[model samples]
Target: MADRAGSGTPISFRGIEKRFGGVSALSPVTLDIEPGEFLTLLGPSGSGKTTLLNIVAGLVEPSAGQLWFGEQEVTDLPARERGVGMVFQNYALMPHLSVFENIAFPLRVRKISRADIAVRVKEVLQLVGMLSLADRRPRQLSGGQQQRVSIARCLVYKPSIVLMDEPLGALDKKLRMQLQLEIKRLHEQLGFTALYVTHDQDEAMSMSDRICLMDGGRTVQISEPTELYFRPQSSFAAGFLGEANLFEATLVQQNGHAFLEGAGGLRLGPAPEGARPGSRRTALLRPENVRVLATDESAENEAIGQVSEVAFFGGDTRLTVTLPSGMSLVIRGSTGHGLVKSGRGETLRIGWCDSAVTALPEQSA
Candidate 1:
């Protein structure tokens, strides 16, 4: 079973570009996807994530450059010849077919033996945890179950690479989260190369080995989830990936210490490395790094703000704090924190360590 599950394949995209007449949908992108790796194309609408995915799927041909599947240059290969299985957002299951039949369709299309088809179908059905519903039609199953069947169908043939385009987008929040983990588990078990596309940043962060963050029809940054979230190279990457406090601040050296000074005399902890004093820089501070200071406690960067909003989310709470400068910063913390219990109109001093503040390049902003 382990040997049969090793269908992972490496992929390469070199100078791939797409244009619709005079409009460019995807810029020249050069990326390599490792075997058995889960790489997600993440961005908002019209960001060319879909275009790049389609290019790899062979559904959209690149206007220039080449694509390689392992050592094979598949730039001109047809979609059917690419050894790629696609799972789509709409759960493209046959309405009239039962789960078993739907999953067996791909095998049957390739003219596999009846015995082989049954074995493959059974394996994928068990893998997706829907063996009990093999006889159920698409309409009889829940949206998540239908999607599982769709995924099972894609896996039944053991395609070298699997492409999922927002496959969990249609489900509710709880179900979406559930499927995300399920997909990750399956990827770990089956060890299939996966190229996923989604506009959901949380989904990308939670599932991918690395996230390819895209914008303006180009790849902005490709890095691990933690790096992309915490140490983004661009303001767009920082602001787009998560809740961030972005400020235009100036580096100041005083009394042998370096700090950042923002508008309205706002002061923060030490500036990032290589920052020259008297130079203005864009700094990003994440919400989770900010904590409410106690009476006797202090932080390198502290600010007093009025709680403008509060939202409770079971184990944690989020607060929107408006500083004296009219700038707002969001803070998230465990419910046990004193600041998490604070309500609107309450004032509190929130602080973060110097390392929490990251300076961005001027051109990146």
Candidate 2:
């Protein structure tokens, strides 16, 4: 196994920007990736996550600013000279080559001796648990097996940094999940700096030490998965990371607490800090944070709404309740015996604490 702490170099992106003709594909963004850390670029389609990854891979050059890998300035370096390994969605295995030959391709390109190549190929194949299938062609292996070979090829070279672009996108859900755990384990063992790109939120949250979220050609937020889900810094971050109930309101300072006053008898008490009275703001309420309340019970935050939709997702029941104010909110609760009994069109009382509400600045164009 490689030295986990000393294998990779930290990367720095200083004001990187990319543009095609008159439109900007990626806005000026700066970020730092720690050595030997797994960082994921997560976003929807056309969100510029892939573009940023390409910049780091030397496949695309930034129109402005500089890029650094450790102490080397790589802004002018070509992809082949960057000494980075790449894994693609399609596996990119040569169909004619056996697994052993495919994993040895990179070493062969570097003119390594046949004896050294044999040892390296055997080492990586065992690392990915594919040594037994070394002689199988790409056409003979299952999707998961082919992917493992692809990863093995990337790892065989022992590159300090590896880039994965939707490496498991073609596999079924079960296989994808299984490979996700496998990839995480291998990354922990190898400790190569990783830059992973994916549109799947679960995959990003599960694999990344930190996640960088992008939107509309700009970076929205970069933080740990838990922080992005719990304390999203922007309205887009709150809505995009997970399920959120958004309410537009104006801040009003009460005797000792802040409150959010909305239209049509809609109100949420004890607003989050930094809200100035009379300023328009947005509130992000997560579904799991809101709970169904008994008719006589009072709570810190309460609302009366009619259930519009209800869904059972095995582990929990989801309720979409429409308030008298014509706005809707989703609440999720445990699906245990007799819990979440409210049906469609039934009046439901929902309550939550002030801390459940996160106040964010109104989104801008």
Top model number, lDDT: 1
Please provide, for model 1 over 237-256, each residue's C-alpha lDDT reduced to its tens digit, 9 standing for 90 to 100: 99899888899998999899
lDDT of 2 by residue, 196-285 (tens): 999998898888889999998898899989998888888778888878888888887768767987767467756656756788877788
Lowest summed-lDDT stretch of 10 residues in model 1?
A: 1-10
Model 2 regions lying over 4 Å from their true place: 1-6, 295-298, 337-340, 362-365
TM-score for candidate 2, residues paired by index: 0.93
**Clashes in candidate 2: how many?**
0
TM-scores for candidates 1 onward, in order: 0.96, 0.93
User: What's the true lDDT of residue 88 in model 2?
Assistant: 94
Task: Output the lDDT of residue 69, model 2.
Answer: 98
